[model samples]
Target: MMIEAAAKMAQWLRLEDGFTLIAHTSPDGDTIGSSLAMFYILTCMGKRVQVVCEHIVPYLYSFLPYAEAFNTPDTAEKSYKNAIAIDCADKNRMGKAVGIYNASMLTGSIDHHKTNTAYGDYVLHDENASATGELVFHLWQHLGVAVEKSKTALDIACSLFTAISTDTGNFSYCNATPGSFRAAAALVEYGIDIAEINRLVYRTLPIGKTRLIGYVLSSMRLYNDARIGAAILLWEDFLRFGAIPEDVEGIIDYIRDVDSIEIAMILRQTQKGDFKVSMRSKRYADVSAIAGRFGGGGHLRAAGCTMQGQPEAILEQLLQVSTDALGQ
Candidate 1:
């Protein structure tokens, strides 16, 4: 199904000469990987393809293929034939690039989020796919573009691998399916260094990040006899640790694994003084539904929302809601 869809999209895209692929702000491996893969494939076909996102590529993901080719909306050329949004469910998540999408001749969205808005003229969303990269891989086949397996092009494979591995919790999450593994196997066949990618993404945290984690762990609170741990990181905490928003990325996963804990929440302060809440569940907590009540959405086990007011209040609301949901 995805192959057919990608092939259809490729056919439509090939009919045009100029286009742009846009990703959401603070991109993860899936966002970067899917956008870059599409960019590489389109560029390979002699099409003028540019990748754009709100922020510059992170240091860790700069190694992706054609990282230098990504543009900001401010610098992107005018009047693209189409704009492809990858790995993002909603346009607001596109941040600065949202305007480009609004102005495009055509807009297409490719994502794996259940909460997707179906925003584009062409919407390819699969709630079950491990990552948007997997959907892109399938889309390539549908577009009739065969992935040329080679050691030199392993960078593409590595990008896809990282996307899937991260999104699926290294294939342990429920989203990991047979199709997901097939894609992983194909990526591994390219002879990419999975171990190195893992180390870079998961192991090599800066000192400031470590200190930030220390602060988070120290400030953790439990909602039901240690069964639910919540950690709040205000703007002040980031300043104290010399950290940034991205440094708080994976801390909730640590709390989710505590022996008795079934749910965990991480609250961070955004630039607007509002709080961004991320929630994770060990099993059956329906965090997505919980996030939805607050205008955020994601998977059943992993979801998030951005809220107004102090982090403490946001934490209190989320904990109360999650606790109530768990009780039901």
Candidate 2:
């Protein structure tokens, strides 16, 4: 059942002595930032907590405050009494960490995804939130954290700023709500190192990921009179370029940025020897419905689903769906 009383969610968290905070697989800015923000909050309350993820925290995100708090499921100690998922839409997205999350005596989640499956015992979710970090900002109001600038406040604000900034495309995407801008403005008052964050989050790119970008551009495919664009990250590409899972984070958006593309997708070969597609739309196409057709869910503009098949055959199949979606 959906949790109705918002304060109860905060109360549930307040009552816990320790917690295992889980970030979804691939560890995007929103998930990592939300997890770290909560980590700071819970620690400040004298609670023992640790953040866990399925994979190594991406280098791009390691500069954030409490970046060292993340642990792989195997490495994380089992001392936490409760579990809470941050920014995860579903349990499967928790990857290997889902085992610990399931075993907790008390379970909760803080998420903004509209496709959330209500998998937690207590869920604080708002589909209208621009980012899960934004939801965390509001939750802090109830937790007795002052809005004044302090070291703790600055750290919290830095994480929240990254969460809101990256998820909303640096405040340029349509998802950037008034609340999103307002939260950013409020966070800015804490004096987060915005210039350094901009350089790390946007201006910096590792050589491996840089090379992978070249491969993606050179190998991109356009279909349906250039209305749809896609790039495939083959298994060999990982080995040849030494690119990690996080390296592929925003590659799909690059495909969608093209002027003629209505739908953009990235067909990636998962480490488990299966395939999954990350999708995005420029306008008007309900990609969540398309991803839902194959047991995936996200926002109208972005979504993804795992699949098992030959990659080439899968591309052919998705092209037909894209064509039908666009009435081409």
Candidate 3:
């Protein structure tokens, strides 16, 4: 029986069978955090499991526990008894990892995105969740893990905490519900270094990333009467700064932080010579719908898509989409 709750749905996995856990491609802290937390929980339950992704872990998240354990599709198992996507809104988000997930005998997902396509059997979707980790924390509770003993399993706590923190913007994003706060509070009591983790995730950055941020800020352009702001990055920009794809993480937040900017954007050139469009809204306007028009989906406030065209044309299309959305 699939209960509507994530914890109950999680019970559908058979302990006797081995399975694969997937993190979405270009994984963020939320996906990695939730995947690692589940990896620990399922392992402790004596279930054989592996975590896989389509890309290498970003350097900023490398400090996370179990971060080194992610397997790429080239190295993952041929098939599995079960597969569960962690924090992915849709199967497409799984990228190359989706192939292995599909080959499994059973499939499911645990996610908190509003734009979720609702794929997978026994799926658990909680848009109200501050992060997927909040639902994961409940899974811990379902398995009879006592809050008092949560500290004893430091890896589990750290992984869960990291997931919740990154998704909530360290409890600052509007998505942080009371339940989210409660989950984070309980997880931190498990002996994770809250200050150090925060410093690492938010305050600290590599020299190359810092240079990239400076470039983005200096090159930022405003539209829609200065309500929309964008920082466009060509492949050449990355080469000039010695920046990798990982370095582009969180660059959009800086633009979104502008007082007059309601919509912040990043136009990054992907390896395939195409532009990857990322959008974030401050007050209103569903950026996800705009991204969705281009075959992408995410939250109302944050979303993205990839486009193959001249940079300026892509930006104009996105602007038109955003303007139409804002008009509505």
Candidate 4:
């Protein structure tokens, strides 16, 4: 069903022009990579395409081909013939680009999240897909953008590789499937420097990030008899390290790696005094349901939510829900 949807959407996109590709807010590798892959494909075909996201492309992804091409919604033109959302499960995730999506004559969505709301005029979702990049690879094939012949194939391959590699934790996560490895193999055949990409994304972190991670971990708390680990980074913590939100990106992974920890969570305070919580589960817990309680959601193992409250109070609320989920 997802393949059929992708084929139909590819046909529609082939006939469309003046497209705006929207990525989700606080965009991750999957969102940025998938969106850029579509941008390159459409641009190579002589279609006018603009990629928009609420936040700047993080410095970690700056090395991606055409990373600088991403535009803030405010800088985009007022109108587009069509809008396609990549890697976003819900319309709200479009963030500021929701305006562009709403203004377009037609709208579509492509995503791999199992918790997706199926919101959009044309929606293609594959819960089993390792990453949205995996689906985008098939979409490109359907659109007849022959990887071997297209001049832009390298850029598309790099973007897709970043999307797949990061979302799967460098293929270490359980989400990494046989299809993912196969897609990655195809992308590597395009001559992307895998080592360089890995260096830039994982090994090259700013000193601020190092300090921030140390602080976050040092102050972490264990709950429910060590079944859950939680950490919070206040705005002051970011200020101290001179770190941005992106710097906190993978901090929860460290917590999740601890033995006997079934669930791990990290909360960061936003400028608006709201808390953005990211949750990860090793096996049993469904963090998506916890996130959905606050009108946010993502995959079962990883999910997030935004809420307004004092830090301690929010932690208490989250702990209660998490404890209940763990049947503790």
Candidate 5:
């Protein structure tokens, strides 16, 4: 069935021109990588392809191939005959790019999220595929796009490596299955600089982000006998350290590290005065279901939602849910 979907997507790409590919809002490694992989593949096939994301590619991902090539909604062409949304679970998650996606005559989506609602004319969703990059890799194979022969093979390798590595927590997360390892091994055969990529993603951090982490650690609170940990990053927190949204990317992991904590959460105040809540669970708990209650969804252990509320109130509500999920 997956192969059939890939073949269908390949057919669409072959049958159409003027294609536009979209990544999710606040684009992450998987989304950006999948989008770029498709961009390179389509471009190689002599198709006119454009990639767009609602937010800037975070500084950490600037090293990716064609990272700068992704246009914003304002810069992308208004009309496209074909569209493919990569790693985005729903249409609304396409953010500003929804206009372009919806305008396209033929639309499809390729994703690896379990919660995906199959939103497209053609949808290929595999909850078991570790990362969307894995699916994209297979799609490229099904299309007979030889990585070794393609000029953009290195770029494809780097993008897929970043996508799978980051999404699986550097191969440490439970989602890192045998297939993830196989995919990573294949990408490694392309001779990607694994150490450098790790340094860029896991080790490199700006002073501002360091300070922000300190602030968050200093203020983090534990609840339900340390079964739940919560932190709040107010707008002032960003201003104080000259931090950006990307700076808060991995802070929730620290909360998850607390001994015996089943759930961790971070509430960050967005520029729009709304709070973006990131949730993580060390085990058993289904954070995605918790996030869905607030109109958000993601993987079981990791999920997020955005709501308008004071930090305290939001934290209270999330803690209630987290504890209840843990049966504590």
Candidate 6:
């Protein structure tokens, strides 16, 4: 069935000379790696490929293969053909590429997020997959596309490896099963520097991010009798510390560690006055279901939603919803 989908997408690709691959709006390693891997694959097949995302690849991850080959919507506005969305659960998360996808001749989606809405014309979404890279790998295998397994040509493997490694929390999350490890080990055989990957991902953070985190930790809140940890970051907090969107990436994990905490929620006030919420769960809680109620979604253990209101009001509403989910 997956092969049939890939074959159909490949046929659609044959109708056009070029295509655009859109990662999620705010890209992480999985999104970036999946997009670049697809870009490289399509380009090698003599299909012109462009990777379009809102932000540039972060400095630390710029060393990924073919990182230099991305194009912005502004750059490829007139020339692109099909639209392929990767690591994105929904079309709105496509960000700058959303308009292009709507106007494109063909649209295909590839993702591994469990909460995916199946938005594209050709969607290959597998929640069991640790990352979109794994889906791409399986799809490639099914389609009978031959990739040289040489150490020197490990671009796709490395990309998939990074995607799996990051989305599964370095393969420590519950989603990292036997198949996940097998896929990762296969990538290692392609000569990925596993040690370097760990160092680069875990040990690297901007100085500004450190200070921003310090502020959040100092003012943390514990709710539901400390069984649920919560935190609030007003726009003023970020302004005082020079924090950006990416700096607040892993703060939810901090709250998830509280003893007996079934759920954790982090609410941050974006500069635009909208509230951005991040959530994590310890066990037996389906945070993605709650997030879906608010028009956002992610993995089972972690999810997020955005709302239009002050942080306090939004937090009150989500607390009620999250508390209800804890009982379920």
Best by TM-score: 5
lDDT of each: 0.83, 0.87, 0.85, 0.90, 0.88, 0.80
TM-score of each: 0.76, 0.74, 0.74, 0.76, 0.78, 0.73
Report the C-alpha lDDT of model 5 over 1-328, residue by residue, as the tens digit: 2878878878887888998999999999999988998898888888899999999998889999899999998999876788889998889999999999988888999999998989888888899999999998888777877558355888888888899998998999889999999988988888888999999988989998999999988988888887888888988889989998878978888889888789999999988899999999987999999999899999999999998877888888887777779965
TM-score of candidate 5 versus the correct structure, residues matched by position: 0.78
Candidate 6 per-residue lDDT over residues 1-328, each given as its tens digit: 2667777766675566778898776678899988887776776677777888876777767878877766666776555768888988888888877888988877889988778898878888878888888887676555444567654248887787888888898999888988889888877887878888888878777877888777777777777777677888888877788778768988777678767688988888888888888889987889999899999999998899899886778878888888788784
Off by over 4 Å in 3: 1-10, 146-152, 215-237, 245-249, 260-328
Q: On residues 1-328, what C-alpha lDDT tens digit does candidate 3 reach at each position?
A: 1245555565675344687999999899999988998888887777788999999998889998879999998898775688999999989999999999889888888899889888887677788888888888887777764435544378888888989998988898789888988887887777788989989988987777899999999999998887899878999889899899868877899999999888899999987799988999988888999999999999999999999999999998888888887674
Q: Which pairs clash in the backbone of model 3?
A: none
Q: Candidate 4: misplaced stretches above 4 Å? A: 147-151, 215-249, 260-328
Query: 149-229 in candidate 2: lDDT tens per residue?
Result: 678888888998999999998899889999899999888888988899989999898888888888998899999888899
Deviation (Å) of 256 in candidate 2: 4.2
Clashing pairs in 2: none
lDDT string for model 4 (1-328, tens) is 3767987898788888889999999999999999999999898778898999999998789888888989999998766789999998888899988988998898899899988898887887898998999998888877887556455888899999999999999999889999999999989998888998899887997889999989878999999999999998999889989998878988999999999899999989997789999999998899999999989999999999998889899999999999988975
Residue lDDT tens for model 1, 231-307:
87878888888898888878888899888888988888876788888999987788999999999999998999888
Cα lDDT, model 2, residue 309: 91
Q: Each model's number of backbone clashes?
A: 3, 0, 0, 0, 0, 0
Q: List per-candidate RMSD values in Å.
A: 4.5, 4.8, 4.8, 4.6, 4.4, 4.9
